[model samples]
Target: MISDDIGKRILCLSFNQTNTCLAVGSTKGFRIIRLEDSKTIIKRDEDSQSNFPGGFSLVIPVFSTPLICLVGSSSNARYPFNTVYFWDDYKTSSEAEIHFRFEVKNALVRRDRIVIILEKITYVYVLNNLQALASIETISNEKGVGAISYDKDIFVLVSLSKEPGHLRMENFYTNEVKSGQVHENPITYVAIDFIGSIGASASAQGTIIRVFDCAKLEVLYELRRGSRPAEISSIAFSPNQNYLVVTSNKSTVHAWKLEKKEKSYTSMISRYLPNYFQYSRSLGKLSLKTEIDLTCPYSNITGPKACFFTENEFFIACLDGNIHKCSIHPVSGEISIAQSLQYFGLSSVSVVERGRTWNNIE
Candidate 1:
C-alpha cells in the first residue's frame, strides 16, 4: 500500500537508489515501502511512528547508498531547523546527524558531497564525516533548488546573481563560478545532467525551459512546456542523458528527446553543436521542439510528481494516492500507460535509477 497517510500527514516520499525500495515519511513517523507485486508494500505497521522535525519534512533518499535523510524544518520543531538527520534504514530514530547554523532551504546529494541550500548561504559537506568543506553567501532566493549531474560528478546550485534576474553557479571543488542573465522572468526550476556539464532552467514565464552548457556559460536549447502558464513540479534527465522528463501543474509529464546527430554527413569538417543549438538540426540541439505527454489518458491533479524508471519506462505519482507506470515505445516515442497502482501517497516520488540492496531489518 502507498501508505504515506499512515501517520498524521504525508511529509516526504522518496525512492532509494535502486528504485526497489521507497521511503515514506509521515507526520507521525516513517517507513520503508518495498515496491513488490506491482504495489507498495510496507514492512511493518510500527514503522509509522516518527519524530521527524515538524514543518516541511523534505526527506530525501541517498543515491547509491542505504540512507534515508531529511533536513529538519519549520521554526518550532523539536529538532533544530538547522539540523540534518539520517534516518538510517527507515527507522523512526535518526542514526547519524549533522547540524548547520542557518536553516536549510534545500539540499542535494551527489557522490561524496552533500550540497545544502540555505536562505543566504550554501554549504558543501563531505558525506562520510559531515565535515564542512565550503560555504558561499548566496544571492539566490530562499527556495533555490540544487541539481546534480548523474554519476554524482558535478553539483550545481542556482543562486541569484548580483545583477538581478541573472543566475550564477559556483563549483564546490574548483571554486569556479559561472554567471549569466539566463532569463528575464524569475527562474522557476533548475536541472543538471549526470556529469554536471549541462544545466536546464525554466523561467517564471513557465512556457519555456532553457538548457545551458555551464562549461561555456551559454544556452544550448529551449523547450516549450505549453503555450499557457504552468507551474513546473520537476525536471529530471534520464541516466543516459537521452531523455529529459518534466512534470508540471497540468498533471502531465513531458519527455523530450535530446538531439545529437549520430550519422554525420562526413566525418571531416563536421560542425560542432553545443547542447542548445538554435542552428542546424545535426547540431547539439533538440531536433524537434515537440514533446509527447507521458501522462496521456490520465486525469489531472494539483501537481503530479514523476521520474524515470528506465530508458523506456517512467512513473508518475498524483495527490490522489495513485502511481501510474508509463512507458515509451522505442524509436517511435509513443507513450502508453502500462500499469497503475492505487495505493500510494500524494507526495513527491523518487525512483532508484540504480540498485544497491541494503536494508535495516530489526
Candidate 2:
C-alpha cells in the first residue's frame, strides 16, 4: 500500500484485467473508477456497516466485474493481514473468505484464478470454489514481486528467490514451468503483457529494463532507462505489446519500443564490441506533470503509476490523486499530455515529517 503516514491515506491501487477500470484503496475504504469517463462506479467507505471498519490495503477487481478481492493493512485494520475477502459489490457483502497462517504480501486475481503471495510461498486457488491448485516455494519476496497475464490463457511470473535475480514462470495452459534469471540484481518489478507472450522485469539497480519472450525464456530487449540507480515503481506493456512504459522514483516515465530480436546493427556491433552495445535506449520520456507527496511512505503512492489506454495513449496516476492523460507521437517519440483530472473525493494531503520508507515495511 502506498500511504501518507501523516494521514494514512491511499493504501493501494490496481487496474482490472481489462484495463477498463481502476480500484483504489485508502484509509477511508476503496473505490472503483471507470477509465473511460473517470467516474466512480462504486465507492465503499469504512464507516459503512456492511464494509469493514478498517480500510483495505489492497483491492484487486476480478476482471472488471463487481467482485473485488480485498486485504487489510496494519493501520486501522479490520480484516486480518492473512485474510482475503471476496466482496460482491452488487450484493454489498462478502461472498467468501480465505485465511492463511502467514500474512499475505500480495494477491493477484484474474479470470478464475487467485494467487496469494506470502513471504516465501505462493498459493494458487480456483476462484470459483477457492480450491487449492498449487503452492510454490520462493525466495525472500518481501516486495511481493509477481505478475499475472490478462489473457484467458494464464501465464504467471514470480521471483524464484532461490537466486538473487532468478524468475520462475508457469504456463497453466501448457503445464510447463520455466525458470531463468531476468536480472543480475534482485528484481524490483515484473509485468506480463495483455496476452502473456511478453514479460518485462527491472532490477533494484533500476537502470535497465529487460523484456522477455516468456515461451522461450529468452531476453528480447535490454532497455536502458537511465544511468543512475532508482527504485522502479511500475512496468506495463501496451495493449498490442509493441511498446512498454516504466515509472520509477526518479519522476520520469520512460517509453521503449520492444522487439523479439536485436536490431541488425546491435547484433553486428555487439560481436565487435562489448555486450552492453546491445542495450536499447528509450524512445521517449515523460516527466510527471503533477507534484508528488515526498513524505508518503509507499513507492506505489509517491511513484507515478501508468497504463496504456491504447498503444499510443496512457494515464499516469500519482499520489496527489491527479490522473494525467497522455499520448506519445509514434514517429517523433514525443510524449504529450492530453488532460489532467483530480479524483474529487480522494484524499490528497501533505505531511510534515517523512515516514519510514515502504521497502522496510513490506
Candidate 3:
C-alpha cells in the first residue's frame, strides 16, 4: 500500500545513467528508493541543519557514483543555497563544495560534469575536480531537475527569448550553442532520449510537443499532449526510444512512437507549403503541428508527474501519497494501473543507478 504522505511536496527528481534507482525530493527531505519495490535505500532528514535548511528543493546524483551528490535549498538556511555541496556521505560534511554568490535553483550531473543552475545564471563544473567550465545566461527556467542526460556531452534547457520560445542546447566539450524555436509559445517541457540523438519540447499552450534531431537541429515530429491550455508536468523517452511518455496537470498521459509513418499526398503537399509546415531556416526541416491519451496509476489532481519505468511502463505520483505503476499496451498505446503503492507526498521521481546509503549527520 502507498503511504498517504511519502513526501508533502516533491520539489524535484533525478535519475542516474541506468535508471535502476530513484532520487526523490520532497517536503520531508530527500530519499533514494529502489524501483523493484518501494524499498528506501537511503534518506536525508530535512529538520537537521546539517542536512538542509528547509527541505531539499532539488537533488541530483552523480552518474553511477554512489558517494557524490548535489543539492539546493534556501539561501538563508544554516546549510545555505549559494553553494553546490559535493557531499561525500552526508550533507553536514562535504569532501568538496562549490560556492556561488548566487543561490542555486537546480542542478544536473553528467559523467564528467555537473551543471549548477542559479535563478539568473548557469554554471558548469567538471565532476572530477569541481572546476568551473562554462556559463550560460539565456536560461529562463529552473534546472533540468527531472531532465534527461546523455552519456556523452550534449544537454538542453529552456532559454530566454524575446521573440519566440527558444531552447539553448550545449555541446559541453565543444562549448557551442545549438538553439531553436520549435514553438511560437513559451516552451514548458523538454526531453531528450537516452542516447542523446533526439530531443522534445512542449509549450504553455500545451497543444503540441515538437520532437527534433539534435545533430541537424531539425524538427522530426510532434506528440500532441492536449488541445486545451494545460501545463505538462513531465515528459520522458524510453531507453529504447520506441515510445515517449508524458504526464500533465490532467489525469492522463500521451505516448507517441518515433517510428516513421506512411506519407500521404497531403503530407507531401504540406512539405512544399512552408506556412503549413513551419520550416526552420537553420536546419531546413518541417515542424509537425499534430496535437493529440491514456490514463495512469493515480487519479488526476492539481498536477501528476511521471517517468518511464521500463521501455513500456510508467509511474505517476500524486500528492495524496500514492505511486501508481501503469503499463502501456504495445498495439493500442493504452495505459492501465498495474498496482498502487502506499507512498505519500512524493513531489518528484527519477530513476537512478548507484548511490550511497549514508547520511549527512555526524
- C-alpha TM-score for every candidate: 0.72, 0.89, 0.76
How accurate locally, in lDDT, is each candidate?
0.57, 0.76, 0.58
Winner on TM-score between 1 and 3 is 3
**Model 3 — TM-score against the truth?**
0.76
List per-candidate RMSD values in Å.
9.6, 4.1, 9.6
lDDT of 3 by residue, 216-310 (tens): 55788765564567777767777788877766666556667667767887767775775525322111111112111111122112355566868
Off by over 4 Å in 2: 1-8, 46-54, 154-161, 260-266, 289-302, 344-362
Best of the two (1, 3) by lDDT: 3
Clashes of 3: 23
The TM-score that candidate 1 achieves is 0.72
What is the model-wide C-alpha lDDT for candidate 3?
0.58
Model 2 lDDT tens row, 1-362: 33334443566767887878878876657888888778889888544444554467778998768899988766545687789999999998889999989877888887778889888998889989999999989888877888887677565554455778888888887887888888899887888887778888988899999888887668878899988998888888888887789988777899887756736865666778765665788889987755444223332344777889899898887766767788878887778888987652434343444443321110
TM-score-wise, the better of 1 and 2 is 2
Candidate order by decreasing lDDT? 2, 3, 1
Error of 2 at 257 (Å): 1.5
Winner by lDDT between candidate 2 and candidate 1: 2
Top TM-score hit: 2
Clashes of each: 14, 0, 23
